[model samples]
Target chain A: MAVTLSQDGRFHRQLIFINGLLPMVLMGFDAWRGKLGVNPAEFVTRATGVMTLVFLVLTLLVTPLRKLLGWNWLLKQRRLLGLFAFFYCCGHLLTYLAFDRDWQLGTVFEDVVKRRFIAVGMFSFALMVPLAVTSTNAMIKKLGGARWAQLHRLTYYITIGGVLHYYMIVKSDATYPLWFAAVVVVLLGYRVVVSLRKARERVAVGVER
Target chain B: MNPISKIPSSEITPEETFLNRRFFMKTAIWAGSAVATGGMYRAFSPRSDVKSTGSEIATVVDSTFQSSLGADEKVNSFGEIAGYNNYYEFSTDKSAVAAKAKDFVTDPWSVEVGGLVGKPRVFGLEDLLKMESEERVYRFRCVEGWSMVIPWVGFPLAKLLSLVEPRSEATHVAFETYYDLKQMPDAGSAGIDLPYVEGLRMDEAMHPLTLLATGLYGKTLPNQNGAPIRLVVPWKYGFKSIKSVVKITLTNREPPTTWSLANPGEYGFYSNVNPKVDHPRWSQAKERRIGEAGSRETLMFNGYEAQVAHLYAGMNFEEDF
Candidate 1:
């Protein structure tokens, strides 16, 4: 049997929060040690971008994995993972602004307008801001369950946008980006199938009555 | 006997410079595969701390390499230059290239200079090294918005091209890098197409500043840095400086280049470093000078417009880029 992390355990959630920050800590350590290679700016930007994608993909996996494994506790951990994704995306955008564009709003705006990938990435990040803001329990309560759930469905579009951003920016090897795209597609497919099955069962029950 | 130019022997980077990235290769070999990062670093912490916060590339700089800091152009430390490379033949991951290329066989190599040439010949590694070696300190800019100052030791590409004696119709020169399926396992997946090719107009090939570099920092190139032979076009983006070249062909038609063939929009045939023409993906207006903080304004023609501008005197920078 494999060692398992329980979905709702507070200890595991805390562990994950620390674990999420670990990469940045290591990056800072490497930067300090002069071990981040010759191009530290590129390193930070790339590292944060990669982390954003990793967390975003992992966030997408939560619902699917929870359904398959029957681990309802995974829902309790979803907010933390989703927030980390947002955090890393912020780092990614800021690193580009600071190092690549010299904190120039005009330059970064030009990039967003002229470059398709940057535009997609910024749009995804923009979508994430509302998701992060509404993630609070109070906001969820105020919006009511059904409306909040409906709005949160935008996660699918945001994830798709993130994958598109990655696919467009890669120089040649689309292998990794393609892999991410495939996984996101499957995750989205699962939801569509589940909803269609539920609708068919509801119709069958009505006909029998 | 040909007279040679060299960086002063007094400025040779100490042996400690060799100890950094090679640590991974050694550990990977011992383990017969990749190991965890912490173990690798523990096994290879070669540099001692100076004033000891364990932070700062400047402090880690070898005294020999540090002396050049006073000069207007500080030549990057040998380790820093070699450790960060973009040899797409091995992999697209720049820093990972060193470990992947550690065991590459460069000794028994030959470059075939043939197409549209009068005297076709394949020059062995030894024969190529026999040419005069000159040390030129150049600012190397990449399309991805990063740059480095390197002291490259090699003879001009003109010296080798002249030997081949191109026919009157040979208007362009195409170059290719050495690609072995066994040695370069990552070539198949390295984003761009393999057997990397680059072209220069025949006049560009013969220009005095265009170099055929074999080494840097007064030493033979570490395998990661295109050992044995590579083209060093200082004015163009660094990718134009093809590495570990194994083939050179002179042609009447403009030759197809690797990056341009992969994606025509981002890269172009004449990838001269023009700040006015930005890469569609990133701004070329400014670049992060490697090993330094903050971005600096990128120079037109990488600050070599005075030297090589006449070649493109009539061409438009926007379209050519």
Candidate 2:
């Protein structure tokens, strides 16, 4: 099915931007009001990390949804979602650095080296940097679409790494992270199925010709 | 329309003077009346039950029991201390434990003290409380890298062990937390092997600082904070202080602990609070004190090193951890 990009793309983009900012604003308000509960630092850190993963998963869902559901308008919002994921990833790291670690670079460095979850989390955030930097139209045009798409493919690995980081960090319960992992697997599975179908369709077209 | 304009500037009391006057009045009332004998002021103090979660406060006072406080340690507000807990038998979420444990019935509680003791016996909660109890404010450190200073009311474990009369063969003491599927809804789903168990070497169990806490902050232990009776081993991580204890067994071998049984490598049986020893998932060098802004350096044996260091003498700290 051929899907046309809707003229309401700008409106959708604005809505996405506001939606992305809403959690940040709410978290700030909660922090100000002592509503984050006993360990605000841990609460904020986990919240931002979860938000980052949520946005990353949503960003990944865009491609499969566009192909499977014929929702081409969803493609336009992918960059915003990816940027929001990066924003929250930064928030998660900053919360850990400023509040939890008190900006002790040495301690953080030690943790990144010693703790498996911290190391994986740091790696996932580092992977997002290039994709975030090249999210612009100019960068896409400069790098060409094929190369840009290949580079952005790091998102899949980032998502996996983020989920692993979360799964490993939790003391015992892995229910939430396992659920996130299941979602990623389903989304990735959809992509594989769509590609197989496309391959089969191409063979049918060749045979008809 | 302005309320402030109705009161003349001279007639208005300064905020400092107003607060001081209120404190003065409260002190005067507390000192001058028969209510003073009943400790009415303590019951009605602003800090007593602020944000309390409806846990009963025991009226028993151990007037003779007193202990020194740490130099700069401040008692975490009753609400904050009680509001936050990690009783996994009840729930995993720290803040959820209090509410979830509200319906838990801890009375008619009996502790079976057995194994290597000369005589195995079960004692009711009231019977245990009949023993001498004292108040000690100690720094509590959790394996999750959080800390709190708690004012615990209890007697030393040594005194209890003396009554039980452990046999010469006793090498370790193991404690089991009460686990009723009906009362603790999460017990079936907490993933840990149930009837949460913890252990200490014979010497560690007999340490002077080891307490069988019955209350906290001059109140009966909240269900969430381990009601009826619980162990309070301040030098070790908080989990070592098993909550809602039911059985204490003296054994010749190291008994399996809940966390250790779940993940032996991550949680050792001797889970003492040591800054030098780090958990595989996180650092133990520093801990975020609950209600405090920033992390502080975690102490060796949680600052009871002078008392506990000899227990681990000549042993590899990493292996013991």
Candidate 3:
């Protein structure tokens, strides 16, 4: 299918942005209304963490979705999804630091060292910083598309790390994290299949020539 | 006016006049008001020690039993105690439990006390209530690294065990929580073995501090806080205090607990609140007290060392944990 810039494409882009901002606004409202449930700190922290993983998974889905369903407009939403993932991750970290730790840097540092899940979660968040910074078109052009794509590949590791962190933190019932893992596997598998098919096509063309 | 005058004035009096006709009726109303006022006065009176608030769980405070609180201890608000819980049989999310557990029917509940006991018996909710119960303020420590000071209203486990008459071979007391897939949606889905089971050594079961709580903060337990009855082993991690218990078996061998069965390495059978011992996933040295901003240093045996330390005197703390 041929990709085209149409009115529908512009509308979809706006929808994606609205979808990303909706949760942030709802979370703020929930927090304000004291509706964050029993443990507000933990509720916010887990909510943001789950949101981050959700957006990360959604961001990973864009390429496969476009390829499989021929929804070319999905490519435009990928950056929006990635940025939303980063935004929620930052919220997750802030909830931990401000509400959970009460800005006690020493305790937070000790936790990062002592707790394996926290350590992994922090590391994953740190890796996201550069990707988020270079997500802009200007920075992408500055770094060159080849190098930018290579740097952005860190998302795979970050997603894996986020899932692992989630899996480790739960006391029991790994259902949600397991589902996330399955999704990640499927997305990555799609990418592998597509690349293999493209390689086969290139070889076939070369042989025909 | 002429028609009204034709009627007898005494008979045509207002309804208020009829209400005041009999002295007995007047006295009855006065007595009823006095009783209502007296009941309210007693409920709110500072001198009235037993303060039973209206709640769904139906708790009755025993006035004879006595309990005192430590200087530093503070009772967590009933809202906090009831609102925040980890009744995984209902749900894993702490907040979801309160609402989800509303579907649970705690009335008409009975617990079967059997196995290795000479006189095994099935005790109904009322039968359990008949036993002497007291209000005790205790520090509750969860294995998830959170702590709360809860005012529990119940009797010692030893009193109930003694009535059952455990056999000479009985070395441990095992507990099982209620399980009904129709009622507890998460019971089938939480990935834990159904009918959550917990146990304590015979000595621990007979300990004076081990209470079977039915109420908190002078109110009947909220469904989320384990309505009808539950265990309250203050020195042990919160999971050790099984909730909505349906069965208790006295056995020679150790009983498998829910968490220990789920992950043996992470959760041990004892599950005593020891700062020196850490859960495989997280540290137990410090704990965030619910309703507090920052964490506090966890105490050995949750500050009941003097009472429970001798129980585990020879055992290795790290291994047993």
Candidate 4:
């Protein structure tokens, strides 16, 4: 698939569309079939959260995959993937507001203040708004590459907020959040290690000079 | 991969076709004979297994007595009552009591009555049930946090304690539940103190709001529900109504309770379902109407404030809370 997708925009688009929407469709079908037993509101909330994390990870992988494997096509799909992450994050917030809070804005505000989980989730959602807004090619050009990259760095903080939100809201099981945290750690760990190595190389070069 | 005709004669066998035909005939005959025999049995035999009454199999036996509730009663029936639970030891989950409490053994359940009473005696559940009049009706409110109107049928707690004839040393009455961790499984596992003990002032115990319940919705109490007997304090949070009760100690001084001891700032022995007194963690002003049976506003003192509020009129709820 990677060999064929080297020059193929259509193939990458197909991959993005299927990866972004298939899980949602399957979950929706299961819900409509009454297989989820209870209200399925929590299920939707959980699924959206997980997919948000998944797309965030995929978006982060773009730079590394391009650098290592010389697949520039991965860079073209980053914006789409990041937008999809925000889309699911919006769905996550919507499910909580609609089913959990009944869309009572007053109560939603109360929850944002009163519950720590809501605060964390709202923060993650807030971070996504800017990322989604700047995802367009025109905005990217307007912001310029350096400033845009700096702004998008907020996604790391968004990932942390998302994980904490999930962890705090879960009353019993920590396994899912624990797994997500571990994955986030590994991904973020890669970036930190690369940065540190680059810093050491720059220092060593300076000393040699 | 080759066609079947390419096989050797030795491997095929001359009698193979004949044996196969015979086997098919035998299978057909046996199946036909079995069906014919089953039909004959159905035709001649009495329909003992058939539910001609058009009722479901009773997983629980029906109670001989009715709730015979007071004038202000609001609920009835086993289906409605049994679904509602107030077991806090198993966590706040509504199904927790029913699911986790099966591990509790109420077989040799007995209550020790002492202190300030003229007749201090230990009474088994069987003996206690014999003394009380049985009636089933909805009683609601729990501390693990939920509300349900249940069809409960047992004599008033006041009526039974009167048999003991207090000598008036009982300024405060304390109730103790079975404390055996071996028998009551969730006692230590819940991360909350187990064998929960709750107390009421002597007047509160003798009040009409207190009940020593044995059965509900016209049947023996299910094993998960303290089985043989439990207390029902309709005005208090469900935790105040101790389950699998085995002892009653009337004291000259106020007795310590599980929640008060566990979190002094939160739960008090006088843990009445008052809308005004909010729990430290959440509001007691409102409660989710479980089973979605009726979305009625949760009442003050679970709507029994008129009957129970006066007991704590001079006292501070926030202090003890």
Candidate 5:
């Protein structure tokens, strides 16, 4: 905090941009060099899926961090992180459809309907579509502040569903998924405590008045 | 997860050719570059790295029980076969298994035979080796939907069971692998019940294809690939082929298996490879061969139906699975 750079500076945004794209660039290099492991398709799918979850966690951290430190520019960074989460989600789904399902839409549809894990994953991805569409400045303005904030609340449910999707898919080990669940729970728990405190403060003010 | 999985057998020198002088120099060059690049052939490349000196290499003297199945499919290099493994007693990570199991001691191992058997004898490693050996090139299929072609060296399970003389009351054969909390320290965290067990009906156990393998690719079994002695039920999923086996019991009742016990809905006692019967969580209609990029549709009984389908004749595969 002693020597802070401007939170909304172009350099800061550029840094995030470069870092966000770095995973894909490295993955591409590995693919070109034939280094995506025994099952390259599996490697790509898992990498993109994990990246999506990582971005989702970062995206939710923005609101709490901004509230605690009073760094509102972090709000500006949130949308970009959310968008990157969506971007990796796209990659995850694309790899599964092309490599795993062989672009067989009928089978994929059946998978979505039949497999609980696939159904959960598809539900989360579908929830992301509306958030992504209303992410622009004009859409935010059209929806207005209170309405936009209410709609963007979907991130909480989407992140929960994302973790569930991961938990349900793994074979035996649930250690990674459990850790993801813990982080999301703590993040959500903060909001719950803050809201309760605010309500108590308002009741005290009303009694004094 | 090693990228050497993508290296085609065509690019690799054939087994006989790779054992020569020129190939030894090539291995050194490859080793230098692999170390410089920080990967690829670092751990078990060229297969010879794991076995130092010719005497340490395991050699199979006879080709007793050969199968023509998957002959067109090139046998995976010794590195690929030994490098990637699913021995849960060692580790769950396939690529990391070889390293974790390297220090494993397979000597002083003996398998006990009992329960409803007339002879019911324990055969040590030395005596087990005397029965016979074979080179079986079979398609290896994992329950998680991946595959490989392996040239396993062993004899039929019937050959070993014959020495014990199963009793008339015996209806099923139950096999259990050796489990030591100290020897396989990591197995405590493997998330499955230990002393991995598998079972087959008596007739199925006696089938010509049920192998008691001691090695692979003509070398003695590496620790990761179930050293000393292991079962090779090619028609069933890989888990049914229990590794590091210690006990064989002929029973009158169906024996509980590890995967089935872990998740009965997803894994069944009769986990034969079938294209029509998909796993509850994931589709098993197709599988990507380990070294290949694309997937091929799975075969019923893993393409050994002609030899094994009759075993499941009256049973409904969908219900049993």
Candidate 6:
């Protein structure tokens, strides 16, 4: 039974890996075929940003899913979801720097400050970097428990910045931003409720003692 | 794959995504969705893609005819006239005016100069241009955030207003853009205030800073850039520089501008690019020199304070602005 369960887990892992590579493959194929048009960088960068938001929301859903569905095992996949979110975020940032501005530092800096959309995007990128760096067990251990958790709390800011960036960049139509904002509200609400419950239990225990 | 298993797997599992599932199925579901969505967007959208269909694009008569201007008057690069736009009714996209504005009917364009004018006359584009000398290069500033210097070819608004012969009661001059909600798709959108109009105080209207542009880059103004005629107030935010103007009404009372009414805090009557007055969303400390990659420090009144600042005079800019 243990071996079979391990095999299933491995299969899921492989599935996740395949899923991650698929988008990149499709992007490459589109570029090669000249179907994606000349601005492949814009496409790739925008896709990565949207995917990052999607995965970040998914990562935040682990705790809620565990409570709602009695699926405690969902917690085990949280880090994987978070790391995938970070990966896409890195890709998004790289594409902007490499293709959008042709790796011009001055132009990139100006865009980050001068353009409202770029500024929000850069803020989101800034937040994601810290979360990505501390994702590893060694770094998490070095930062200690409370500090590590506090550092990861920057995800809330990141999600806000990402949504704002998406909103500002688009010339018109805000349905995507509205959807992401809704998901983020739910995710953050769940965290707040869970934290309140934990705090209440701690206070109750102390009073009883 | 088995749905019957009740026991939760103890081992830490990696995550999976929709794309991964699609890959396993050997189908690009995401790409398919994107293409379908794009198609739906195009089909449902009222505005036609001007670039797609070879609609009546205005002939760029003179390819190398950058307007003649003094060295001090010229910016390093006149922003891409193709992109720097004022297509208020259709859309706000910089490229939208150039791309989708050809469909706009400009041949029969006329201006109704009424209100405090002694002779309120509706003059056609041909008649109007014939009345005034060609054009002048002016810097274009947008309210949404961006600035551009364009080699605009048009005579001063003061020049035309002087010809009209205004009454003493004309304290404010209001200009209205030709607004057809059906034709200009963006007019119907909740985000924008329809029938886009802007006003200038009597002094500003009479000032040399004000222009009524008929041509740009020594060519007839592109339909997207308000081909027939448009107001160009160099010192104020771009929205104040109204476009595709069909009417100019000089009234005794100050007219409420479309932008100031839409967003009171961000856009004011005197939306001078003052570094001191930051926009609600972002700072106006630096502006990308239109057509150039690098940005320069944004000056007070977009570097036109010396000439136009006196018009504000004793009025507190912070209060009225």
Pick by DockQ: which candidate is best? 1
Interface RMSD in angstroms for candidate 5: 12.7
lDDT of 5 by residue, A1-209 (tens): 11224443554465567667767776787678766655566667877887888899998898788888887777778888899999999999999898878888788888888899889989999999999999999999999989999998899989999999999988776767889999999999999999999999999999999
Tens-place lDDT per residue, model 5, B255-316, is: 99999999998899889999899898878889888777678888899989999999988999
Clashing pairs in 5: none
**Cα-based lDDT at residue B309, candidate 1:** 91
Q: What TM-score would you give candidate 4 relative to the actual structure?
A: 0.64
Give model 5's DockQ, 2 decimals. Answer: 0.14
A102, model 3: CA deviation in Å? 5.1
Candidate 6 lDDT over A1-209, as tens digits, reads: 13333235554555455565556566676667654422233446667888788778877787788898886666666677788888888889887666555566787776666677888888888888878888888997999989998888787888888888888765444656788999899888988998999999999999999
Error in Å for residue B155 of model 1: 0.6
Q: Candidate 1 vs candidate 2: which has greater lDDT?
A: 2
Instruction: List where candidate 6 sits over 4 angstroms from the true fold.
Output: A1-55, A58-81, A84-130, A137-176, A183-209, B1-79, B84-88, B143-145
- lDDT at B16, model 4: 61
Better of 1 and 5 by lDDT: 5
Model 6 chain B: ten consecutive residues of lowest lDDT = B48-57
Off by over 4 Å in 3: A1-15, A99-114, B1-73
In order, how many clashes per candidate? 3, 0, 0, 12, 0, 6
Off by over 4 Å in 1: A1-8, B1-71
Cα deviation in Å at residue A27, candidate 5? 1.6
Return the clash pairs for model 3, or none: none
lDDT of each residue in A24-95, candidate 4, tens digit only? 665676666644322244346666787788788788788777877897888888888998898898888888
**lDDT (0 to 1) per candidate:** 0.79, 0.83, 0.81, 0.68, 0.81, 0.69
